[model samples]
Target: MAVTGGLIYRGIWKSSKRFGPFPKLAVAGILGFAVGKASYVGTCRNKFQQLGLEGGPGSGPWSRRGPSGRGHRSCHHVFEDCKKKDQVAPAGEA
Candidate 1:
């Protein structure tokens, strides 16, 4: 991103000499690296599944340490129980 911004700045803002193909090559290299890593990880996942292994040790590819977007199931149960009690509460305790 920096290289791209520099190239654009030099070409338009400064109107100075271009940085040749270096900036383009740098961007391409960065993108290529990202694609390569994704492909490698995907290959590892496929092989692991083929071997019938559940998950490996030490931050395995199959392990998801991030949020699943569904929130926690235990928290949902607690909230449901609270709602149930609240519905049954006496009118004097409102």
Candidate 2:
């Protein structure tokens, strides 16, 4: 990751010398961050789909039991719900 970031920084620094150093650095940082985030999300979605967590036609066990009868849910929606559930205190413990 550090190597990738350094490459991005170097490329941006050389290509946009007209811009101030800080601006070039900022653009490279934002671009790197965005790329990293997108890669992570895509990987997670693919893994979930492979595991049948994102329910659909070939979704193993979850295909028949999805909240929607159609058996479909976005990876983002599923993960956000999981996060929300985890943050809440369970049952009478609270």
Candidate 3:
């Protein structure tokens, strides 16, 4: 990122000379990296269900870490307990 920024900085520094500085562009490049990593983690989660973990936008995916660092469960191991508890929670909670 820094290298890219340096190249971009040199390429645009002269044009931006009138402004205070081109730091904002460099900051944007850095923030882009963080956004890239977060999206990557989400993409890697596609195997969550296959790993015996839940696969949804809500609670199911948050509660199933196995003893080993990696999760391992049959594909059918849905969150039966979570579903039961979910039924009794406030209507807005589901």
lDDT of 1 by residue, 37-69 (tens): 988986787776677543424334323531212
Per-residue lDDT tens digits for candidate 2, residues 9-39, read: 6774243456535555576678899998988
Off by over 4 Å in 3: 8-11, 14-22, 56-94
Q: RMSD of candidate 2 to the true fold?
A: 13.8
TM-score for candidate 1, residues paired by index: 0.36
* Candidate 1 vs candidate 2, lDDT winner: 2
Each prediction's RMSD to truth: 14.3, 13.8, 11.1
Candidate 3: the clashing residue pairs are none
Q: Rate the local accuracy (lDDT) of all candidates.
A: 0.55, 0.57, 0.55
**Which pairs of residues collide in candidate 1?**
none
Native-to-model Cα distance after best TM-score fit, residue 28 in candidate 2, in Å: 0.4
Q: How well does each candidate superpose onto the true structure, as a TM-score?
A: 0.36, 0.37, 0.35
Q: CA shift at 37, candidate 3, in angstroms?
A: 2.5
lDDT of 2 at 53: 60
Best candidate (score: lDDT): 2
